[model samples]
Target chain A: MSTDLPEWLLARQEPFQHGDGIAGGKSIRRGFVEKSVDSMSLVFRESFFAERLASRPGLLQGIDPRVKVLTTILLIIVAGLARHPTTLLALNLWILWVAKVSRVPLPMYLKRVWLAAPLFTGIIVFPSIFNVVYPGDPLLILINFSRHFRLGPWTVPETLAVTYQGVWGALVLILRVGASVSLAVLLALTTRWQVLLKALNMVFVPQVFIVMLEMSCRYIYLFLQTTSEMFVARRSRTVSRTSTQEQRCFVSGSIGALWNKAYILSGEIHAAMVSRGYTGTPKTLVSFQISRLDWLWSLFVLAVSLFFLGGDRIVAW
Target chain B: MHIPDGYLSPQTCAVMGAVMLPVWAAAAKKVNNVQKTKYAPLMAIGAAFTFVIMMFNIPVPDGTTAHAVGGGLLAIVLGPWAACISITIALAVQALLFGDGGILAFGANTFNMALLLPFSAYYTYRLIAGNSEAASSRRWLGGLAGGYIGVNLAALAAAVEFGLQPVLFHAADGAALYCPYPLSMAVPAMALAHLSIAGPVEGVITALAIRYLQERNAGILSVEASSSPLEGHSYKKLMRGLGMLILLSPLGLLAKGTAWGEWAAGEIEAKMGFIPGGMSSLAERWQAPLPDYGLPGFEHNLLQSSTVYIVSAIIGLGIIFAITYIFSLVQKKTTPDKT
Candidate 1:
C-alpha cells in the first residue's frame, strides 16, 4: 500500500547521513518575499476591484460619501450596542443586503469577513465556553474528573463541560464581531478611497492628517512595487538557501536602502508640489453632492438602527 | 497589538482618545517649530514607510514568519513625536480603509502602538546611548534594547486593555460579554509571545537597520533633530496629560462588580447582604451627558456622547497647548539668551 501511494505524497529531501539524527526532519520553506509580494498583490487586486465596484451604478455607490461614512459609523455603533445574537444576525443580514445592492462580489465579501472574524476572534473566545474557565450551567460535558480536586491555590472543578452561558456569550461576542466587520468591509468595498477620505475630511478630521493619509495612500503602491522588485531581483540572483544571518542582514540593508529612496522621493515630491503651487491644504476635484436620495437613505438607515436598538432593549436575551 | 472593536469598553476608548488629543496637539506644535515645511513631506513619507514596512514578512528561526510593527525604527528615523503622528495616521488608515482594527477602538490602538511604543522605545534608546558618539556601538545596543522593550510594552498595554474589558463590562450572570479573558490569562500569554518571538525580532531588525543607516547615510538623523522652540516645556505637558488620564482611570473602577444592564435590586442584596449606598445612588441617578468621559447635558445617544467626548478632548488639548505656549513665553522672557 505504501509503494502504491503517489510519489509526490512523500516528502522530498536527502536521507540522513552518518552522525545525522533528526536533521532531515526539519521543514525550511523558502521564498518569504515572493510569498509576501503575492499576498500583498492579492490585497491590492481585491481593493482595486473594490474601487471599480464603487464606480458602478449601484445603490451605495450612488449615495454621497459623507452620508455613507456617517451611516456606516452609526450602524457600527448599533452593532456595538447590540446584546442579543438575533439582533446581530439581523444586522449581518442587513449588511448582506447592502453588499448585494452595492454589487460587491458576494462570495469574496462573505469570505473576507466570515473567514477572518471567526478564525481570529473565534480563537480568542474559544476558551470561554469551558466550565472550568467560566463557571455556569453545564451544557455538554467534555470531561468528568473526581468529585472535587485542587491544583495549587486554584480549585479544580470536578466536571468539565461547555457552559450554557459561556456558549451564549461566545455566540453573542462572535456575532457582534462578525456584524461589525461585515459593515466595515461593506463600507470599504462600496466607496472610492479618495471619496471616503474626503468624507472623513468633512467630518472634522484635521486637514494635516487628511493630507498625510492621501499622500501615503498614493505613494504606498509605488513603494510596494519598488520593494517587490528589489526582492525579486535578489531572489533571482540566489543559488541556494542562504544562511539566516545573511537573510537578516539583507533585510536590514534593504530597509535602510528603502528609507534612503523614500527620503529622496519625498524631496522630489515636495519639489514637484512647490512647482505646482501646492499649499499645505489638500484640494480634490471630485466634490460631494448629497442628493434627495441620500437624505432618504440616511433616514432609512437611522430607522433601521433605532429599530435594532429597540428590539435589543425588548428582547430578554 | 491592534485591538479590534468590542474588545474595550466605550469608556476606555473615550478616555484614551481624550488623552491622545492633547498629545497630538503638543506633537504638532513641536514639529512645526522644528522644520516647518521640510517636515511635511518627510512626515508623509515616514507614514508611508511605516505602512509599507508593516507588510514585510520576516522569517524567524522558529520556522515561522512575522512582520515587524516598525515603531522603534520610526522613532529612530523620525523623532518620537513625528513617529507618533506617522504611526497614528498609518493605524487610522489601517482601521478605516482595511478594517484591520476597529474604528471605535482606534484611540486605544493608537495609545498603545503609536504613543507608548515609540515614546518608551525612544526614551530607552536615549537613556542607554547616553551621549555616546554617533558611530559608537552603544547606539546599536540601545536600539536593540529599545526595540525589544518597545514591542513588549505595547503588547502589555494591549493585553491590559483586553483584560480590563471583562472585569469592567460583563453580563449579570458573571459571563464576560466583551473580551472573556481575565488579566492573569491575558498578561502571561501576551508577554510570552512577545518575549519569545516578536520582541527579539524587532530588536535584531532595529539594531541592524541602525547599523546599516550608520554605514550609508549619516544625514538621516538631522531630519529628526531635537531642537525646538518648546523644548523646555515637555515636563509640564506630560504631567497634565498624565493627570487627565489618572482622573479618568478611576472611571474604570466605578463599576467594578457591576455588569452592563443586568442590575437587579434583589441581586445586590443577595450578593453583598446589603446594597452599597454608592451603587444604589449611581443606579438612581439620571444619565450624564458624557456618561463616563463625556460632558454633561449631551443627548443620551452614542453619537452625542462620542461627539461630546471628542469636544472635551479638543478642549483639553487646547488647554495643554495654551499652557505650553505661555510657559515658553515666560521662559523666553526670563532667559532670552538660553537659545
Candidate 2:
C-alpha cells in the first residue's frame, strides 16, 4: 500500500460514498440508483415538512386535536353540501384564514392545495366545459363542421361551441375540490401525527386501528432507511447500469427480501414489546386537555356550518 | 386514483363513510381476536411494508415506471382480512399525514383500494390456484392473473363510483354538482389506464415476487414441504415465457385514442353533437382558484401561463424546504450543549 501523499492531497478529504458501490458489470443504469435515491429523499422531505408544520405555534396548533378533527369533518361536510358558488368561495376563504391564523405559510398552503387539486381536477373537468358533453347555451363557438358527423350511436353537431352552463359547472367542481383539499390539508398540517391518531379515540376509532397507525408511522422511516441502505449497497457494488431484465429481477427480489425481513422484524418487534411489559394494550403518555378555547372554536365551527347549510337551503329555494 | 374532496356529494360521503365504519370495526375485531396483542406490531409492520412497496417505481417496457398498490400481494401473503386492516391503516396515514387522498372521501377510497382490491385479489388467486401444490408454477400464474384482474376490478369499482355521481346527484338545472362524467365516459377512461398500464405492472411484479420467494426460500411461503431441486429448470422456463408476455403487454395502451372523458372541451365538441346538459350546465358555475392553472393577471399567453405554473410549483417546493430548514436551525440554536 502506498502511504505517501502530497500535502495538498492529504489535507483535502474526498466526499464520502456508499461502500464499494462502483464495481458492477457493463449493463448498469446509473439513473436507476439515482432515481431511487431521489424518491427516498422525497419521502423524508415530506415527513420533515409535515413535522415542522405540526409544531408551529399557531391557532389550530393550540386547540385540542380531538376538537380539530371533529370540527374539520364537520366543516368538510358543510363544504360538500354547498351548492352556490358564493358559499363555496366564502368557505375557501375561511379555510385560508384559518391557515393564516395557524401560522402555516400562506403561500405554501395555497400552493399545496391548488397544485394538487386544480392541476389534476382541471384535466379531469376540462371536457365538461364545452357544448359536446354538457349541453347549454354556447359561450364561444370553436368550430363549424360542414355537415353533422355521426359515429355509431353518437352524433356530432354542425356547430361546436363552449357552452355557458358547461363552463359554470366545471368551475363549481374545481372550486369545491380545491376548497375541500384546503381544509383537509390544514387539518393535517396543524396537528401532530401521534396526537391526531390519539384524537381519533374521541370518535371511537378502534384502538387496534390507532395502534396500527402509530406503529406504522414510527417504523415507516425505519424501513425506508433500510430500503435506501439496500439500494445503496447494491449501487455501490455496481460499476455499470444493469440491463432492464436484470433491473426487473432485482426489484422483484428486493420485494420478496423485504417481506421476509418484515416477517422477522415483526417477531423482533413483538419480542421487544414483550420485554417492555407485554400487554394487549399499548399506551402513550400524552393526555388530552380541552380548554375554553377549544370549546369556543367548536362553537364557532358549528355556527359557521349552520349558517352555510341555511344559506344553501335559502339559495336552493 | 385518489378522488379528492368535493367530487362526491355530502350524501355520498356520508353513505360511504357509514358503510366503511362497520368494515373497519369487523376487521379490527377479527384481527384482535386472532392475533391479540401481537397483532398490532405485526400488522403495523405489514402496513409499513405496503407503504414502502408503493414507493418502489418498477420500470415497465413502455419507458414508464409504475407502482403496484400491493393490495393483492399482501392479501396473498397475510390473508385477505389482515391485508384489509393493514391497507386501511396505510391509507389513513396517507390521508392524514400526506393528504394524498381526501379525508371526507376516505370511505370511498378505502372501499375501492382496501376492500375491493385485496378481497378481489384473494378470491381470484384462490380460484385459480386451487389445490395446487405449494411449489407449483400454477400458484405464480394464479398470482399473475389475480393481480391483473384485481387491479382492473378495483379500477372498475372506482369508475362506477365516479360515474354514478352525475346521474345520481345533480342540481335543479340538470347540471351535475359532483363528478361531471357519466358512466359512458368514466368506465372506459379508468379501464384504459388501469388495464393498459397498471394491470400488467402489478401482475408481473406479483408473479415475479412470488416466483422469487419460491426459488430463494419457500419457507417464507409458510408451508411445510420437503425441499426439492428437481423442478427448478421447468419453473425457470415458465417464468421466462411469462416475462416475455409481460414485456409486450404495454403495447395495448398504444391505441391511438384518449380516454373518453379525458378529452378537452374542443375535442369533446368535435366528437359529440353537444355536451351533455348535466355536465355543461354545472361546469360554468364557478371560477377556478387558479383559472387554467395560471396567476390572476397572467392567465393568457402560453409562455407566461406555463411560466406561472412552473414558478408556483417551484415556490411551493422551495418554501416547504426552507421552512423545514429553518425549523431545524431553530431547534439546534435553542438546545443546550452537554459540554
Q: For candidate 1, what is the DockQ-based docking class?
A: incorrect
Highest DockQ scorer: 2
- On residues B49-110, what C-alpha lDDT tens digit does candidate 2 reach at each position? 98888888787776557778888888887766678888988888888877778888888888
Q: Evaluate model 1: give its lDDT.
A: 0.77
Instruction: Give the alpha-carbon lDDT of every model.
Output: 0.77, 0.76
TM-score of chain A of each: 0.88, 0.85
**TM-score of candidate 1 to 2 decimals:** 0.82
Model 2 captures what fraction of native contacts? 0.58
Tell me how each candidate scores on DockQ against the true complex.
0.18, 0.27
* Model 1 C-alpha lDDT per residue in residues B169-285, reported as the tens digit of each score: 777677677788888889998999999999998999989988988888866744455442336677487768778776876675454554555667678788769998888887789
Off by over 4 Å in 1: A1-30, A278-286, B226-230, B252-339
Candidate 2 interface RMSD after superposing interface residues:
7.8
DockQ, structure candidate 2: 0.27
